[model samples]
Target: MSEGEYRVAVRALCDFTAREGDLDHRFTPAPSAREGIAGHALVAGRRGEGYEAELPLSGRFAGLVVGGRADGYDPAANRLEEVKTHRGDLSRMAANQRALHWAQVRVYGALLCAERGLEGVTLALVYLEITTGRETLLTERASAAELTAFFEAQCRRFLAWAGQEAEHRLRRDAALRELAFPHAAFRPGQRELAEGVYKAAATGRCLLSQAPTGIGKTLGTLFPMLAAMPRRGLDRLAFLTMKTPGRRLALDTLAV
Candidate 1:
């Protein structure tokens, strides 16, 4: 947390900017979340004593925060890895997924290089199979400058979107601070609902409210959600409803 800093996770940055091509899960085979976690542990356990697992790392690119926990790092060997769990043919992975995986590791490599002040480092993708417990290793040696350049390119591609998001947040928060209640006064449970929404957004958590009808639910939720824009660093507030009528209610709430 610092001035002029745009906080972003390393995974988010790579997922956002490095994505291309249509979604094709036709060939890729992967394990469940729980299984993946176990697989990661298995690989980390097999590493040398000098290796560090779940290495929390971060670096900056023009105020954008790029951060992630690399699966493992061996300081002695100067290697960083991103562990992936899979089953079936690894060659079947889509090109887009491969590109994204490389992008993530490159950003991580740049972070590692910067943190260690090394001229270059080895980046690896360690894929472990859930069924056979076999591991596939893919690696590349990259200079710090090259990794930095790669990281910069990804950040640059996303910079404009980030800028617009930041600007929108400022405007939205300013409006919220000065926003007046749609009605002359609050309803019975509306104030509490609004407060809950604001606090949830501020804390970056979910809020579940259960109140009966006729409690100004629309305004209650929308108002505080808007008010929390700046503090929460929210790029957008999405209001999802099951039906068209509910969607209209949300839209009308905003218009008010």
Candidate 2:
């Protein structure tokens, strides 16, 4: 689907890819970046208190596991902080920001509570401007019970979404499998092409194919894809034939 038509989750994937690119350009260990972050904060707010950054626990898959990186967790302060970089003014701290930032921090807070002995943890969203270096800090508190309930809800939502995706895929697979090229036996390399197409479709990929005559190309490809529907969520595909006779042929071929 087009980018504009994509779901928010899909867009998030795109956003993540962009961030990965940024990390690639200047990849620095969280530990190494501590001084840098503190320095940036200092530059952003000369009047602010001393800025200190640390990488308590780092994992490449931490966000996927717990939701997002708990950039800084202060067991002493009973709070967590996430650093974000934005282009525009950093003075604006809004409500949506509060909820979203809290959700993320709760993830960290929950982790800290689980790993450490903290009962509850507060979260901070430290937004900093790229051009001006100005910064703003927004903090929200979340209890252990609150985080647990919220995370469970998140899991339910994710599962529901996954179920829908699976259903969509199954329907497409069924469509491909049930479609027939309107021929009896495989011709030349048609069997291989059909097999390849089926494999690609099953894995949810787009393919460009050229089939030779008498190979039952439509039937070969479609049948496999259709058959995979139950397992891979493959369902439907468009079958367009230029000739009126070809459409009839396609229908007849599937009968075999």
Candidate 3:
């Protein structure tokens, strides 16, 4: 959230930078979120007493804070795992998905080596079938240096894009700070609405406001919200409305 620093979960970092090939969903339907959680728990329960579940791992690379909880780790075996739950045939799973899975575990492996100061670790992909409660594990032994190099390579790829994003944000915030209300003066009761919106945004609080129609409510809300965005370091602002007319009003206000 800070300037020059981008915080990303290890899985997310892999999902963004390591994913390759076309997204194919031709295989059987994947397990549900709840099923995946339960599958992970079941797998952990089957592990030995020395096994550590949800082990926290993190590392820094090129101003990026990358962190995530590994599914399970065995100190005795020097093994780290990433558990994935699925349904149907494993062979039918898309190559791209499998590659992404490997990418995730490798990043986790890199972080684990850094965290524990290990020379190397066994990176594993344990795929569990929810319906049958069966597990198929695939593993590879990787040295600390190799994993670290892989992690940094991915970070370098992400850093180039992140630098562009940060520059865009800097320019956007500067523009927002310099923006002024379109009209010369606020309509009656509109100033109160604008002030309330600004306060809510600045303080990170919820505000419930009600105003009658035809009081310049659209502009009143949008202008102050835009003005407050830079102060709060907001990355995005979403204006939701119930109907098309409401959306049009908000867009029309922006045009003015």
- Clashing residue pairs in all predictions, respectively, total 0, 20, 0
Q: Judged by lDDT, which candidate is best?
A: 3
Q: Rate the local accuracy (lDDT) of all candidates.
A: 0.86, 0.55, 0.91
Judged by lDDT against the true structure, how good is candidate 2? 0.55
Query: Each candidate: RMSD to true structure?
Result: 3.5, 11.1, 1.4
Q: Give the TM-score of candidate 1.
A: 0.81
The 10-residue segment with the lowest total lDDT in model 3: 23-32
Top TM-score hit = 3
TM-score, cand. 2: 0.49
In model 2, which regions exceed 4 Å deviation?
A: 1-68, 91-94, 160-188, 196-256
Least well predicted 10-residue stretch by lDDT in candidate 1: 22-31
Model 2 Cα lDDT, one tens digit per residue, 14-62: 2322222123322112223454465445543543333334434311121
Clashes of 2: 20
Q: Of 1 and 3, which scores higher on lDDT?
A: 3
Writing each residue's lDDT as its tens digit, candidate 1 over 162-238 gives 88976876777787678777788899988989999888888888878898999988888888887777667565788
